[model samples]
Target: MDSQIRSVLPKTDFNRRSFVVTSIAAGFALAVLPVGAATITTDTTGLVAGEVKIPVKGGEIPAYRALPVNGGNNLPVVLIVHEIFGVHEHIQDLCRRYAKLGYYAIAPDLYARQGDVKKLTSIQDIVTKVVSKTPDEQVLLDLDATVAYLAGKANTDKLAVTGFCWGGRIVWLYAAHNPKVKAAGAWYGRLVGDTDPNHPENPIDIASKLKVPVLGLYGGKDQGIPLASIEQMRRVLKEAGNPSEIVVYSQAEHGFNADYRPSYNPEAAKDAQQKLLAWFKKYGVA
Candidate 1:
């Protein structure tokens, strides 16, 4: 094993196992069961979409990938990090949406080694058993592994990354972690919070170190992420002279881009999507 992977490995049974969730689930997570009627589904027509295994330090983890069927190997690459729900149908759909726009999109199962959140019935349980146990270092390594897996398949030189909720927070850390990334779009990701050994720093802690421009799309009504924290992050970015920017939708709540949730805001989601694409294009990820 690489010394770096060994250093970040959680001193738990996880180190003894190859993987917990070997494959991506087929539908929405049970925690979000009874998916809302407003859920949006993207068709895979004219697209090559399905599951594939990405090799990591220990073993291979599954991921959902989508790209235009006729798109050559030089297609722009976009890494789609999934929410806490894991790489369920929604995340897969997002990959398809990106493929329709001529980008090779892939969402790796980051929680595969920790546990499967899709089987858990409650969000609290999922967080306690999986999310909380997942080390930030491990997640970043897995994402790096995912990118490495794209080496000959996509144009990594035009790499971009975007994520939602838990994955969104990762966007900030990843932008700082990987200099090859051209742009990033973070939607409703936490900016600050208590840290542990595994999570040594929050997004705010590295705001000044960001070399890749990030477009943060936030929901003003998200009680979990206070307006104060957003302002704090904004102030830090401004003081650092970072090109990163944040947009707040006053009427939208957390998970506003989640079409399958009651908190979904169509207007905000649409606008945020446009901004995300434009941000990527402006930063040369298009």
Candidate 2:
């Protein structure tokens, strides 16, 4: 198969709601494994952690949902957005970690309708075959469906969102789209990108329109996302009088929170997690 994928379908004919990634993938992505011992795997004891179907417009997509078994319906909801690699073990384990902390955490496989990037070998191939084919409008609709599925049980008013890498950009997009969101944490998502029909706006473009507070965690040394772009986003938020903020860890590189990667920075990840929880708590999402 040609890894250099052209546009898979016409923009008008693409209906993300009609398609779904039905299976919750197992283990780490083939491209990233062996994930090694550094990756954190939170056990499901005292929690319900597994696949659940979230019904969309025409079908259902599989998502990994984790929440305390004993916690009642009042728990805060946290949407876990996966990296470009998709919702594999590390993303599932992160959901479990949040569940242990008393939040109902769910990581929906955002690329379900597109090809699975986990099966692809290289980052560029994965992006071309899967990520590039996914549309921002589709992502927001699927996420809205996920949230609506938990409407009666989860506290939407206290809703928060967090994402890693590709998902980080989504966190910002969701915050701008959903008025119910209280807080969000974006981890190393690209701050700027070219405008296309699939991805019409980057985080920088939406910063002024953010409906909720977002805490952006970025690496000063990240080669993919430049500090200049981050600074530009900060200036936009400041000018808009938005409460959103961006923090740059001087010693960290991209994917610092991904313990499965060589780019993981323990100090930055830990500190970022602490800041994330605190930001959520302060904004009523905790």
TM-scores for every candidate against the unseen true structure: 0.95, 0.94
Superposed model 1: Cα runs more than 4 Å off: 1-17
Give the per-residue lDDT digits (tens) of candidate 2, residues 1-286.
1112234444433453555457897798988977757888789999988999888766788899999999888899999999988888899999999999999999888888877777887877887777777888888998999999888877777899999888998999999999888899999988776756677778888889988999999999898888899899999999999999899999999899999988999999999999999999999887
Highest-TM-score candidate: 1
What's the C-alpha lDDT at position 50 in model 1? 95
Model 2 misplacement above 4 A: 1-20
lDDT (10s digit) by residue, model 1, range 1-286: 0001112324343344569989876899998979899999999899999999998877889999999999989999999989878899999999999999999999999999989889999877877677877888888988999999999999999999999998889999999999899999999999988776667788999999999999999999997889999999999999999999999999999999999999999999999999999999998988
> What is every candidate's alpha-carbon RMSD to the true fold?
4.5, 2.8
Decoy 2 TM-score against native: 0.94
* lDDT winner: 1
